[model samples]
Target chain A: MSARNHEQWTSPPKLAEGEWVDSRIYSDQTIFEEENEKIFKHAWIPVCHESELKDAYDFRTMTIANEPVIVVRGKDMQVRAFLNVCPHRGNMIERRPSGSFKEGTPSGTPKRMTCMFHAWQFDMKGKCVYISRQEEGYQDRLCTADVGLRELKCEVYFGGFVWVCLDDDIGMTVEDWAAGALDCLAPSLNEEPLEVFHYHKAIIPCNFKLWHDTNCEFYHDFLHYHNRITGFNDAYFARKNSGFKNGHINVGSFEVQYDNYEGFHSREELSFPHLPPNHWYMIDMFPGVNFNLRGSALRCDLMTPLGPDKVMIEFRGLGLASDTPAERQTRIDHHNSIWGPFGRNLHEDLLAVTAQGSCMHPSAEKRNILQGRHENETIHDENGMRHYYHEWGRWLNRSPSNPDEEFDEALIAAASAKPAEVQANA
Target chain B: MAEKHASTIEQIKDVIYKSCLYQDDLEWNSWLDMCSDDYHYAIRAFSPEIRADMEYMGGGLEYMKSLTQMLPKHNTDNSPLKRHCTVYKVEVADDGKSASATSSFVVYQTMLDGINSHVDAGESRLFLVGRYNDKFEISNEGVKFSDREVRLDTRRLDKGSHWPI
Candidate 1:
């Protein structure tokens, strides 16, 4: 809205020959809604790590694609997800984000998911148990089988994260979805079983894609002063970018000497099993999953759209579950140093996307995501962004190069077949 | 032991006020000067996401010292943060060498850029509300913060500044 020459800043930037995305992708409500349906709904998103559900009946509530979902561990020791809504009047069964059903009900009626509205009770398997005076109300008409909570496709992987898919019949497994994207870190994640040490939520004013864009764009490493001092080195520049079959991206497996940065002590104390003390790895999965291992700590965060312009990032820091009290403390300290909410880098990343979002509006003109670099052997390339959009464009049924082009389903299916091979043409 | 810990409540209040003032003014060095040798500063908040009360962020004395030292090298928000702290209770230890103090504090961030550069520039938006659960080591030299845990009631720290609250 600020008066600026259209000749200069208004034009969309080009990333590569075929990798330019208009800013309308962030500002367009129609496109955003379509994304929620086609992309977000069908994709497998890791909502919570299994450690979050420590005990039987322990549950964690999360909202993905504006849908409230509850992932709970049952007495059978299986983690299952149910649509948090009740089948009767659509009231949310459990209001608290997380708790144990084993705590029983207010009337002390064993383990049941009870709706606070009319106290409609259901068991951990989402089976409708006591429908509050069911005998008097249409007895035969309303049995537990007819009123159970809707179940979702849920899977636990790497003994690490709980992956869920809103699409029940979606033709893909988490292994097929991630393929080799998370393979590098899987060994390390489960080397000794890691538990979350730090967790924080940030609801920022930006489109859901803006956060992922920030993660996929390595050219913006200059924006982080601490990264400049420590993370960006000869190894950093030599780090290669790889993409997987389901649109997951891996930016690096590089080394970063934390002691090289001013005031940061040498990270010689503790580390993940497979990684060196001062190493860095970043993985940006499709939809809304990002896992990054930097130095001696592991940070996994996911964001989903709250609205067209609002998104929430739930950040978690993981450390060896078998770590001693002193080791855990060190992990906590190191995690907070850079990856914490008060850290030097994350807020900076959020602010940059926030600034980009401030310029976009549904009524305003489209913006550009120019990711033209193809260094091939460095994290500085835009290949990560290119691969991300390649999957996004496929899912959204649109072309990244041309947003206004009519969506083609066949094109989407074709690209989905070999997404890893989908890349920007030099 | 009581005599050794006998720093007056009024004296403790001054240390709390001075610490808040130093933080608000972005005087990192001066703030560190007031911290005891083993000073540990921490910020904690209840996380619904984690479903537990947890430390969102914090560090020990040397770690905090390094944090403050390294902060200036990073890019922080130019906006100024003003902390309003009220000392509620000061519990002196039986030995009197140390005391625990609690205060309800509110921090506001005021934008200092652009045309809004007058009395209007002073207007601020409430950024955080928390209680300062602090420990002070009262010595012959003075009272210094040994451990300050800012247990924040709010968890939506979307874009917080570089410095500790």
Candidate 2:
């Protein structure tokens, strides 16, 4: 009941295993690097929406686990992803974040990804089309056909999101990876083509998983005054948190009473196709990706882990591509009111995670992060995080509650067992 | 006529300065008083990454007032914002009923108290840098802002603010 000494403070909580996680998992540099190798490098990450690269030869450049990747649309109208490095000298081919290769640069040809370093030209399909003086330099030893940009496994799925995996033989498509986690909003997202209307990114000082954890659980809704005012009814409290395979989690939908807040109105008219009026759904994919659909607008958060203590989160807001100008404006208005950089809710989430980051630094004392709340898997329950860390442990081959030890299946099994079974075991 | 224009410009400059002062002081009601009944406010930025112009936030006078009034209830950064503005150009309407002006502004935030206040207290960081494209109505009452567009050059706001910049 009172403040404890150092020995008691450092000990684990009274909850069963897998009901809590060690702070070191968020602050350790070695574990951060290991995550890049075991989880992110192989995961099918949604790099960019297809609408961003609408035309042939238009490309977007981004990074996954520090590896620069370029996604471009070829003349054949196929979206492809490749390593941004040039084959000749490994120099990064595209320096710009995004642009069209329809026009030729000073050192390159038209419709080609040109490496300014050595004038090596690559076609939209990643074929090495031109090499600088190939015949004179090495004669038959080297040819354009032998060296090409490394292509990655890419697919446009789940409502035109361009998903790419660094590992070519990962043996699972993006749909398989999702494992029905996105079924809640699949109809609405796929009902019509969507185009991004707003985009912004923030580099928060926190582990990438911490951001994903926030999305998986609604216990932190108390921190958001806007949500509390608009969504504190019985239905909101009864919303379920469902976990899927591969660490994905889905929060069921509920009709948000937007009229509860002053100057706010219902989003029924502008809601996405097939969606009920004023409803909201959220899906949190493993290793940090979030798809949130709030009736009128769709907001996706894509995380790129920069370091143990830093994560760059890209936020995209999308609406139907067939929307009229007025409709699009209304969607943008609804999106910005709660989820924008200057919105009523997002800043509070960022503040909460940043505060956690500051205290869980590498030198900070170790502590237990409790995920023990059990409210029959309702919105406020912590079962989502408990399920997530179970997958995290399996992938990293380490324990979530005690990282120094190997992962133990019995510990997690006992922790998440039924109340009667847990009591019997005790 | 030249003297009248000069005095009008001075008054316009005073209105611009007072707007920033009131916002920095968190005097939301006073800041709203400086705006006309039909005032429009927007914060915008050009994203090179997406190759588009994005409106991050926009609202009318009533909406702005409501949001600002609800700010204290939300969890927000307690650090105070200090806006430094320099009015660059102003043009008075031929009828002398309205005017348009552009000013450069840089906002700095001093960390006062938060989770890491023990270590970050007294530290100041550049929060945002932008230009204000403002339109004012020169009515019988006084100079009131008719429209204000904050075109920001900085896009990445780490732990962004709930309050307008």
Candidate 3:
């Protein structure tokens, strides 16, 4: 209750080797609320794969932080996103999750998006094309020109994945944010259009951050009982720290080199059908999304907070665009086997995260983030948490206690300092 | 061509029961023997809500063989599962070479603690009731499945077991 106590809560612990994380971050309501606004609202979020809407008029509707948003391919086949709610009455304009409508279709027929609530209609460009009560309600006051749906800044990444940003001041573009992580994920596509083999959405009884934090750590592998069966690599994946100018962090995992660890037969003996023996990487976004490219197939998980203790997680499977029907099926099967909501590995993570939530009650305040890696491997020890919290602190307008909080300044300096590198890349 | 090779209604029902029994009894080798080298098995779940696309969770026969071998290490702390399958309807192909069978199943997962248990039971909601839309290739070599699609109705899977349902 004291000002000092409040100050302590705001300031993250100093970055040091073998430092432990306080488990309170997962359970605290204040921290959760702050993150929802600062991270989820401000950071760029992955809406859908571009392959889902390849042709013009292809559209998909999704909600970000409960704000209805529509992703569509416009007249020029350019992908764009807009607020899914109608500007006139706040009713959802798009009914289905995904579909295609003709470029210039009349409202209420088929392709036209007609709001069931008021019969207000919008064109593919989200312009108010038709209004049933146009002159009845108000004569000249109704400005059809100003009634276009609110649009969001959307951009497609290398692998047909689209990320949308609600924050106008987003400092980093998709390219800068991805860095070299994209280089690793790009090959997973195998030059195939990303396809959703099996899509799963689970609303679990736990805070969203708790679930997000569960995947962020590597220490929990021992907690998974299945690790005993499938056999785990003792070769810890080296975690490197990189961030986009907009504050997304690239926590890339080095290639895992496994020895003959006798757990689930042998890794060599029962390996995945067509995956590389020693390749793995994951890129976690600032708020709550992790794009993991495992072997030849890619897995994208987006964790969104519905409430203080309720989280909705979506797991998407992506395969090669040019894969044979059978080959694509095989890729999907392998992808789901290891990573689906029902898959052995993912099930354990769900259980573990739920258990963490159970233990991190409000009464239990003191917590530790077991980042206690050895000195050399701990180079980016608190940097992951620091990088996230640094952005969190900046967005929330609260100064972090860490004296070395120079990520923002460092970003600007790097931009101006490396004129040659920037120009060359540009 | 696939419809021409489907087994009879009765034969299809028996095959579905035998496949479950083969898994329940831990006759892993026998299960492998059921399918020919060109055989394929897919566990798929399709969303009536999301277009006509289907998502395959597990596929191929060799992978199933590997999965059966790997199940022991990953058995949950909960009690081992005992599956009870009941066939409700079987529609045989006119040629009697292949058929589609729909079965209602109640899987009882007993816990090791002996204090608590869980049961996943469902009927032919037309979606979840896993049906063996089996295409048969019957020559002198006896009956073998040319293609088998296990369509499940339950959209969300809590724990995916390696054992075939």
Candidate 4:
């Protein structure tokens, strides 16, 4: 082994305008804080689906940015999200990830959410129902009618996701937030009665946006040797990356050659009725949620920032509710084979993002996110990521290409004037 | 009860040991032979967070066939896997035609690359801790493994092993 030779320190080369970005946007405390407040707080996030909260009184606890959120289904069967922080002493009410509110329910059909701290209780509807010794403390000054859990804006979609926004005035509902992007996917997503069959979460050591970039950037297909062997034919190149207003994107489905891979079996049966056989489609909503659908399976990916250098990503795989035991097994088989926790392609993506985080630690170096391809606006290009950064600029009030300056007014005017058509994804 | 098992227990235990040995030796083809035509193998674990049992890997016999074929392409660690199993108990079916057995297994992976791969050669790293739930079919022809589901006690698989553990 030659121990005498030493490699020279090389810096990330600066590229021309609109070609690269300063990596400081990833680890800079100020930028991360701005993203947590200006983006994560205001953005409409699809936290969980209706299927996960199928039963009455079912609840799921999660943290958005740093805020603990409790998404619960009331006895009336309405899905709602609360701050999860008790109003009395600011203690967490529901401490578990997914559980039922078994308190105050004689029949067990429905119950009130009770807090162990001070015994302050709230109903599933998030209304303050009881407080221990309420009259003794305030003497009717503060009673159940006067106090309740801090509620957030929530809207459900035909796709079965419960979308919540921390912003008081969420400008638009989930339907409008997705604009027409969800509409484009409605053909396949709504036709089937999809239920979440698999849920797994992993903490990738990287920024939330960094992890999200992997979803929108299709050029990384080269990194997956398996995908490179099976996913880069003519059909793959023909994919159209369709962009919508408010940072939503839907990469049109293309027929895949699962059998083309040397070692894997082909997906031959039980494709969603609306989709072409052995085809896949992807939908990435602005800041938080991502979904991909293929034969007999649908996966919803959601991410919440733990820190500037840490991201918690969750993947929920969905299959039709009407699926037989055998059909469900096949669906799990197909989903786990490709998108499960130990999936071939997905693990590679995770490893790549973490590697990027490692090399660009503390965001000392600048990296160019080359968005150069213009070849018929297909999957081989960077149109999706370009559109995503453009939306990022709009939300963060800074150009991704040149973060110091604001995006040109003319570009904003052009986007707002031009109605979002399929071609607009470019 | 141990005496009641007699030769049957020894025979079943021997089959279990051989299966573990074949897998640890990375003799994929030989391990396949030890299984029946309808062989079913699954890697399962329980997740307390979701309050449900989880399957990390597994499928039908056809899925197994495809998985076996796909082994060479997986980007697993450049290391070797060795398993140590202790046959805990065996309960033969009432008809004396089949038996279900459980065994505690610990799979250790040896790192043969990276900084410590060469210097610490043969030093096994803890890979997986689990139990094997096996179903055996005893017949005049031979004792073939009909099913083997490994239920793991751990969840966080850092980078994870591409090959079955």
Candidate 5:
């Protein structure tokens, strides 16, 4: 906490209305802690697609905003979530990243979610159905129902992807959150009903937003080694436009030529296919997930925050589900060539983020002053970072507007002001 | 529904071989025409690190047509691929309507000579050690690929693959 001086934390300059970001947001530990509690916990984070959890009792364990959670399809055919922690001894209930569980022991069958620590058995709904010490000296103190594994709120998106928000209510529904972007992205999701054929995971060293923000903006298009291959050099295709829906954003869907491959369309005229072609549409959801639509294919970016400074990025590639093997290979070959973990484009972003982290010394206290391109758009997306901070400010009671309003003071003032408005309306 | 193949299983292998040879020779039009009208193509990378997950690439004929138009126009430092492929382990489906084929392949790149006429970048590479599992449909004209999954036995891909292996 003492690494950054009081002035660095306190009276720092607000980012210009629509200009450069302050760059210190990635380095601050305090902001990171608040984000974990306020943003990641409250926002609905996409964990797995329902397609992955096809069978009964199939379970997959993942950590959202650092809290371990397990998703399983119960015998009754409901997808449920439970804190991955075992209630009895605090060990993980599901050891494997993904698999299935037995509904009941038929003498030879294994129990669902059996805790390795104390062998406490939990049902698909996370209830403590069986206990080893039920009849022992502890026979009187067993409150099984109350001690079930803690459940988190889980919901399914239109496309069958499962999202878990730690807090039951925080922002708009995922549908409302993705409406505009979906209007443009739905064709890809519908045209082929694409499925994730490649699940590439990279444990990069930097804030998830750094990796994502880089993706949100296309100013770095020329830096990609594969750009030489994609012919993105034309300045006109490089134009970018951004929009907002609820608290999310759709950025950089500027037109680019897509139909000029050796055997595909020869000119850019064939680029548009009921949906805008050559444009790159990036939807940055409230907190961590960014769904990018490059005219060629759809790229889903899930950023799991490790700390304020580190994040794990999983890149999911999608293509037409009904295509022939050769056609699908062509899509995959083109898709993986640019965005996979080893792909040329994202590798540059990873390197850039890693280098940015090393440059951020201990003295930095900035919250990523994101005031760039603020005025160009009506919603002030340069304030997109601010919009996130604004959401955070409302949640944790902090403010970039009034720096003097301490977390405690802001909460008290807002609490006191609420009753006055209620009285006046009454 | 299993559709029975009208042609013998042996004939289908030759079609599969011809498709690869055509792609290696940059015969995009001929290769495009070889697939069934409703063909499905995918190149998947399955990693042991993340079990229960298979990542794939998919596109239909129209999409492939569009992709073919775009691939050559894209400015790439590595252009005009030169490599050889070997197809092995041919398996005929019980119905003979479809067959699965496996192959091993290596791709080498030869670069132009430098100052002393020494090659700038020329090397024979072990591109992939995997089997190509293809589901094929044979017609009187030729063998068409219904579905193909390139299962790479090795987990890590070298840098990136410009051409499909």
Candidate 6:
């Protein structure tokens, strides 16, 4: 009921080990580097949607764990990913965020990703098609066959998203890694081809995991006035928060009463295929990705960690590719009312996580972040974050409650174990 | 004829400046008063990543007023905003009943007591830079905004604002 002194404030709370985590996991530089190596490199990340590269030779470039990556659509209608670095001098092959190699550039021929540095050209399959003056430069030492781009493991799944993994040896497919977390939206998203109607990104000054934590739990709905007005009902409070294997979580569906908010109307007319009117569902994947479906529109948040205290979040709003112009406009309105930059709720989330980042700076005093609320694993419970940090600890082999200590397998057995429902689905 | 046209342009400029001032001061009532009952407002930007134009916010007058009324109940940054605008072109109708203007604007946010104020207090950061495409209805009473579209150039809003820019 009162403020504590320094000693009392710094000590761990009187809670179970898995119910709390050390703040250093969010602020330490070493832990951030280890996360890139241990967690992100092996995880299947949905870099972009397939609809983005509908035309032949169209491509998109992004970074995964600070390594430049390019995803392209070939003439054979296959999508492939490769390291955007050239084999000659390690220069970045493509500088633009997105474009098509279908036309001839000033330095290279058509239908090829040409490195402006040495004009080394790579074909749609990432095969080295041409090396400028190859015989004159290296004689027999090097040939075009020896200098192909390093291709990454790529797949198109879960509603036509282009998923990529940095580790070629990673044994899990995107569906296996999902572990039933995305099953809730599978029917709706897979029912038809979806096209992204809106796109924007923000570079927030916060750890990437912090943003994921906000998405994993609904306890912070109190911070969103719009949600309070439209969604504080019995169904909302009773929505189950289910944790799946590999740190994934899903919040069960509940119909939103959009009419409760002034100047807002029900979105029943444009609900996704096979979805009930005004129903809301969410999927938080392992590491940092979120998919939120609010009846009419789908919002996907893809996070790329930039530093210990910075992360870049790309937000996209999608609707059916067959939507009429009027239908698409309605879906965009539904999406922007709550998820857009000037939406009623999104900026509030950014405000809170950035504040957490400010307090948890590496130089600041260390403390415990409690995730101990237990409500039969319902909407307001904190089990989602607990499950996430448990998996995070296992990956880095460091204790969540005490990062200086080595992780003990027995400490978080309860949180790490898959729920019976998840096991049954698996 | 030239003198009368110059006077009409000056009136249009005054309306644009006053609108910015009212919004920057958070005087929602005054800002709304300068808008017609059918006022349409929107904020838009083009994203190269998606290769499309995006409308971040849009509403009619009633919708905007309702959002403003809910602002106090929401969690928002308290940083004060100051807008600098330059009216570049104003074209008046032959009947003097309507006009259109194009103006460039830059909004700066001064830290007061928001989350990052501990380290960024008293500092002014460039919040957003955009061009405003505006339409007005001129009358004997005064000039009022009929439509305004804010086309922004800066896409990355570090800590985004609840208020429209």
Tell me, by DockQ, which candidate is best: 2
Residue-wise C-alpha lDDT for candidate 6, range A225-263, written one tens digit per residue: 888888988999999999999989999999999999888
DockQ for every model comes to 0.53, 0.78, 0.19, 0.33, 0.09, 0.76
lDDT tens digits by residue: candidate 5, A259-307 = 4323333222222244565555667776667776666566777888787
Q: Residue A173 deviation, candidate 2, in Å?
A: 0.7
TM-score per prediction, in order, is: 0.92, 0.97, 0.75, 0.86, 0.64, 0.96
Residue pair clashes in candidate 2: none
The TM-score between candidate 6 and the true structure equals 0.96
RMSD to the hidden true structure, all candidates: 4.0, 1.9, 8.1, 4.9, 10.8, 2.8
lDDT of 5 by residue, B41-65 (tens): 6556554333534544445676566
- Model 5's alpha-carbon lDDT is 0.59
Candidate 3 recovers a fraction of native contacts equal to 0.21
**lDDT scores in order:** 0.79, 0.91, 0.60, 0.75, 0.59, 0.90
Per-residue CA lDDT of model 3 for B7-55, tens digit only, reads 4445656766787777667888787777766777766677533344665
Q: Which candidate is the best by TM-score?
A: 2
Worst 10 residues of 1 chain A by lDDT: A417-426
**Model 2 — TM-score against the truth?**
0.97
Candidate 6 chain A weakest ten by summed lDDT:
A417-426
Q: Which consecutive 10 residues in model 2 chain A have the weakest lDDT in total?
A: A417-426
TM-score of chain A of each: 0.92, 0.98, 0.77, 0.90, 0.77, 0.97
- The model with the greater lDDT, 1 or 3, is 1
Give fnat, all candidates. Answer: 0.60, 0.78, 0.21, 0.16, 0.11, 0.76
Model no. 1, DockQ: 0.53
lDDT value, residue A203 of candidate 4: 77
Kindly list the per-residue Cα lDDT of model 2 for residues A367-391, writing each as its tens digit: 8898988777779988889889999
Q: Which of the two candidates, 5 or 6, achieves a greater DockQ against the reference?
A: 6
**Model 6: how far residue A255 lies from native, Å:** 1.0
List the candidate numbers ranked by lDDT, top first.
2, 6, 1, 4, 3, 5
Q: Evaluate model 3: give its TM-score.
A: 0.75
DockQ of 4: 0.33
Listed per model in order, the count of residue pairs whose N, CA or C atoms clash below 3 Å is 7, 0, 20, 1, 41, 0
| Candidate 4 lDDT, A319-375, residue by residue in tens | 888889888888887888877656676766776786677655565555545564554
Interface RMSD of each: 3.1, 1.1, 4.4, 3.3, 7.3, 1.2
